[model samples]
Target: MTQIAEAVIDENGQIPLMEPLHVIGPHRALVTVLDEPPAGWDETLMAAEKALADDWLRPEEDEAWAHLQ
Candidate 1:
């Protein structure tokens, strides 16, 4: 299994993790430095809303979930 943890790299090369990484033993890891700030949840969802609406608006999609209603 693979484990992922978010962290911030400092100017002096220090990394402070945002959360605990549960795992055993030592292992090598990869670090990607993003130049741009990550997008907000609202922006991320709205960006996909149009694409997803293409399928979600279909009558078949509503029928599939009609049982729940």
Candidate 2:
């Protein structure tokens, strides 16, 4: 079976898979590393961070977690 998995290879060459794989048996795989980020990656990432912050930095969020604190 041929399948592809996504992962991040850390500075020390440690790889962490992005998601769970449901394969039953062990399979050998190859990893490819990119030396640079894709075009407009910074803009895309900033937009995503803003979108998350809009949802995360709300007054209701504080009320929701008031009990925990």
Candidate 3:
């Protein structure tokens, strides 16, 4: 069986698991480090809002979604 989890690496090169592992005994695992920190809820919302800030106000865009309104 395979399992996945997220962890943060400490300054001393230690990774602390956010949750306890379900499997027991020795097992091989793969680790990948992201280039940038993961975005939280606020960051995601802000990015989406910024991307569509004036989209609805544009004439072409408004017409495209007119049928749904």
Candidate 4:
């Protein structure tokens, strides 16, 4: 299994879904992310913050969290 795909929550307080994604085409896909994932999501999020540092993601996308490389 892979780790979580990171995203930031929008002003609406919603994050982007990351997994179970299916691409219908270049412009469309389905994805999922747990607001509170089981086990170590908190730790994962923290680690992601450290990983991100001063980098900037697309704020318009509402990327409160970001997927770490």
Q: Candidate 4: give its CA RMSD in angstroms.
A: 14.7
The CA lDDT at 48 in model 1 is: 99
What clash pairs does model 1 have?
none
* Candidate 3 lDDT, 1-69, residue by residue in tens: 888898878789999898888877889989999876655746887889967877666889878998999
TM-score of each: 0.47, 0.45, 0.52, 0.27
Best by TM-score: 3
RMSD of each: 12.4, 8.3, 11.8, 14.7
User: Any idea what lDDT model 4 has?
Assistant: 0.58
What C-alpha lDDT does candidate 1 achieve relative to the native structure?
Answer: 0.83
Task: Report the lDDT tens digits of candidate 1 across residue range 1-69.
Answer: 778887767679898888998778998888888776444747988889999999799999999999999
Residue 31 displacement (Å), model 1: 0.7
Instruction: Arrange candidates by TM-score, descending.
Output: 3, 1, 2, 4
lDDT over C-alpha atoms for residue 5 of model 4: 54
Give the per-residue Cα lDDT of candidate 3 at 44.
Answer: 81
Cα-based lDDT at residue 14, candidate 1: 91
Error of 4 at 45 (Å): 0.5
